[model samples]
Target: MTRAHGEVGDPPVGKYEEPATPEAAADRVEDVLKLLEGRWKLMILFQLFGGRVVRFSEFERAIPGISQKMLAQQLRQLERDGLVHRVVYAEVPPRVEYRLTAWGQSLCPALDGLLRWAATRGAPAEGVSDS
Candidate 1:
């Protein structure tokens, strides 16, 4: 019942810690960044977002320059991390599909904000401390 990231300007609510020590805050952010460490993981997740359920082969077509082996590996890792849900169906030819779990979908707003911030692409103002 805790949120991945709260609404902008909203005070820390639910299980969120308030004014965490800088060290603890950095550590927590680092943990989230680690979840997206792999090269194709983000791309794969993006494909599964938007309520789109993608078949195994469809991923190959969606993401260029990714090998089938690499695609499977990334999907498996995402699934293990509880971010991607995989469904398999028995049929004439076995079928598999991938979609983001609610936890994964919750990342949309945060990532959308990050994307918009990145689009700004400007240097920090003069005299701003790195800290």
Candidate 2:
């Protein structure tokens, strides 16, 4: 059966029914959420949003109390998800910098909205207030 561009599956969701891509585009949102599911993803994105491309050590310092292993795992996941770009510079000690990808930057607005909502919604029942 013929399918239109940017459409997925047979019979389509409406007037369009293009074949799904090999990369599985349907799970993009879920994947993005999963990428952000970690404790440090949002914090990392926030740091990157400030227009600072930070070296590996600097990134670690920005995230208080985050374990080195967790940071490494989250950074690897972010890299795999195309949400962050890792640049390696050839120098003594081999410098590596991390910055958000375009897709990652797009998430800033949504994150901000979510933050605002949470601010008004208050903390969870079991949550402790910082103040």
Q: How does each model score on TM-score?
A: 0.80, 0.66
Off by over 4 Å in 2: 1-29, 122-131
**The best candidate in terms of TM-score:** 1
Error of 2 at 64 (Å): 1.7
lDDT of 2 by residue, 6-62 (tens): 211121124535538746666655655676788888787788984568777887788
Q: What is the C-alpha RMSD of each candidate to the true structure, in Å?
A: 8.4, 12.1
Instruction: Name the regions of candidate 1 deviating beyond 4 angstroms.
Output: 1-14, 123-131
Q: What is the lDDT of residue 88 in candidate 1?
A: 69
Clashes of each: 0, 1
Residue 95 displacement (Å), model 2? 0.5
Error of 2 at 105 (Å): 0.7
- Give a tens-digit lDDT track for model 1, residues 1-131: 22221111221237766646988888889987887889999899888779998998899998999999999888877777767877767665777778887888888888899998897677675688779
Note the Cα lDDT for every prediction shown: 0.78, 0.70
lDDT comparing candidate 2 with the true structure? 0.70
